[model samples]
Target: MSLLELRAVSHGYRQGGLFAPRTAKSVLRDASLQIAPGECVALLGPTGSGKSTLGRLALGLERPWAGDVRFDGAPLHDRRGRIAPVTRRAIQAVFQDPHGATSPRLTCLEVLAEPLRAGSTGKAALRDQATALLRDVGLDPALLDRLAHRLSGGQLQRLCIARALAPAPRLVLLDEAVNSLDLETQALVLGLLRELRRRRGIAYLFVTHDLRLVKGFADRCYVMQDGQPIEVADPFGPGLVPPAMAALRAAILPALPGPRPLRQPAAANAVLP
Candidate 1:
């Protein structure tokens, strides 16, 4: 069974001033994709192509305007249009900007500890669990004292990954997870993601514009165009990508500080926000 599935989902946003007539801006049109347990699936598209919106759908963060999002064979939104607490805990996400996503008032320890609130373990062991999780994400336990704004981008992102893993989620949605990092940090985070999946058996739904992000990691890649996922292709296959995107990657990628990817163009290493 698929761990996550979006079936014929049509989503859009309402835009306009309160007095003016509202206009609906369509973002997704009958778009659908599936992520099987233990599989890494990547959604590739340019910004505004609805990739992040699709990630939100997969996370149950928003109710689709049409169609259904199913997790483990059950609808994500109940009749009340609320995502159940249990379902929310089973899926987690790491976005592009760790600084914007987290609370500035909370220390890393406090933020990471939030997810443990849903666990069966008593209060006594929760701190220990937090420390363990930081280690699991390859972060230092000492850095827990720093607030979100005080840490480097890579450090803050690693903390976000630790928080996401705190609940032992079945699926992890990585929406442009490494896009903001320099080449070295990007490589480190990518390696960490690979290790996390191998060690935890957790599946991934990667929302990205850089196909290089999926080349060696994902089993399947879904390319979005025209407000929908238009093609599904194997990451290792040729003739699956648009020529323009390939050209941009070739022309725009910076000189990487780390070793070059075997299959991706240098533009795949761009530190795009």
Candidate 2:
């Protein structure tokens, strides 16, 4: 069974204010995708292609105007129209902006500990668990007391990753999670995510505009256009490319700089100043 699945789901937002007549602004139309257990699936498309909306639907953050979202062959929400506590913990999200994901007023220790409060009651045990989570994400436990604003970009991103993992989620919705970081930081965070997936057997829905980001990381790649996913065979391999894939591939800047020719030395016998 698929760990997460969206079946012909359509979603939209309301437009126009009161007195102006409200209308539905459709963002997704019969869009569908799936993520299997421990699989890394990439949702690749340009901005406003409804990739993030699809992710939100999968995470139960938004209800689809049409179709259904299923987890392990069951409806994602209960009869009361709410995700069960256990189900909510089974899924988590880490968005692009780390700072926005957390509050500047809260300390790192508190941010990480909040999720664990359900099981851990004692203060010392919670602190220990938070410290271990920090270390697991390659952060220093000593920085736990610092406010969110005090951490660097890379540090803040990793801390957010740690917070997402606090519940030991089965699937993580990573929506452009590394797109804002520098190249070096992006590589480091990707490596950390790969390691964590290996150690914990977590599935990821990596949503991004850069197809290059999915080259080695994703088991399967889906190109989104017109709010629907078109599966491509061997994204970087030799074959016919879908129009959406071609467009996205063309948008990716060269990952590495080309080699420059060495300057020739002046003739030794030519002249002396």
Candidate 3:
């Protein structure tokens, strides 16, 4: 069974002033997606293609105008139209801008400890947990004392990722998580995420516009257009790229100079008990 599923979901935003008649600007139309446990699925699309909007629907940040968002076979919102705490904790997200993801005033330790504090009450225990999360994301635990604004882009992004994992989530929505970083940092963060997945068996909805990054990173890729998936392809398989994907590839601006290779995590630190 899929860990996260969106079936024929349609969503839109209201646009207009109080004096003018409000109209729904449709962003998603009959969009369906699924992420099985331990699977990496990419939603590939360019800007204004409704990729992030679809992600918001999946996150239950906004109710879809149509269709259902289900997690582990149950509706994301219950009959009473409320998300359960377990469901909230089970699904997490890491967005593109790490700087904007959390409060600038928060220290690195505090950022991670925020999620972990729900279960563990002691400060020392929380510190230890936060330290471990930093280490898990290949960050230096010594930086825990540093304020979020003081950290570099890569460090802050890694810290944000560590926070997402603090909840022990089953599914993570990575909405262009590495897109804002430098090429080298993007590769590093991607490698860290891959390692975490291997250790935790977590499913990821890896949303992005970069097709090259999806090559070895995603098991399956969904090419979205105008709020819906127009094509689905297996990234690792030997087959012709779908028309939509081909077009997207052609449109890419060669950000990596020559050949852009998706980074793979080192084998030695891949698995953990």
Candidate achieving the largest TM-score:
2
Worst 10 residues of 3 by lDDT: 230-239
Candidate 2 lDDT, tens digit per residue, 1-273?
899989999898999997899999998888888889999999898888889889888889888999999987889988787998888999999999998999999999989988889775599999999999999999999999999779999999999999999998999999999999998999999999999999999999999998768977999899987779878878777688788888876667455356999988989787867
lDDT of 3 by residue, 187-273 (tens): 999999998999999999999988778877888889886678765656334577666676776677444477769897778867665
Pairs in steric clash, model 1: 253-267
What C-alpha lDDT, on a 0 to 100 scale, does residue 149 get in candidate 2? 74
TM per candidate: 0.86, 0.91, 0.89
| Candidate 1 structure quality by residue, lDDT tens digits, 113-183 | 77887776665688789889889888888877777678889988999999999988999999999999998
Model 2: clashing residue pairs? none
Instruction: List residue ranges in candidate 1 displaced over 4 A.
Output: 120-123, 240-273
Q: Candidate 3, clashing residue pairs?
A: none
TM-score between candidate 3 and the true structure: 0.89
Q: In angstroms, how far off is 139's CA in candidate 2?
A: 0.5
Task: Give candidate 3 misplaced runs (Cα > 4 Å).
Answer: 234-243, 253-273
Off by over 4 Å in 2: 253-273
Give the C-alpha miss distance for residue 252 in model 3, angstroms.
2.8
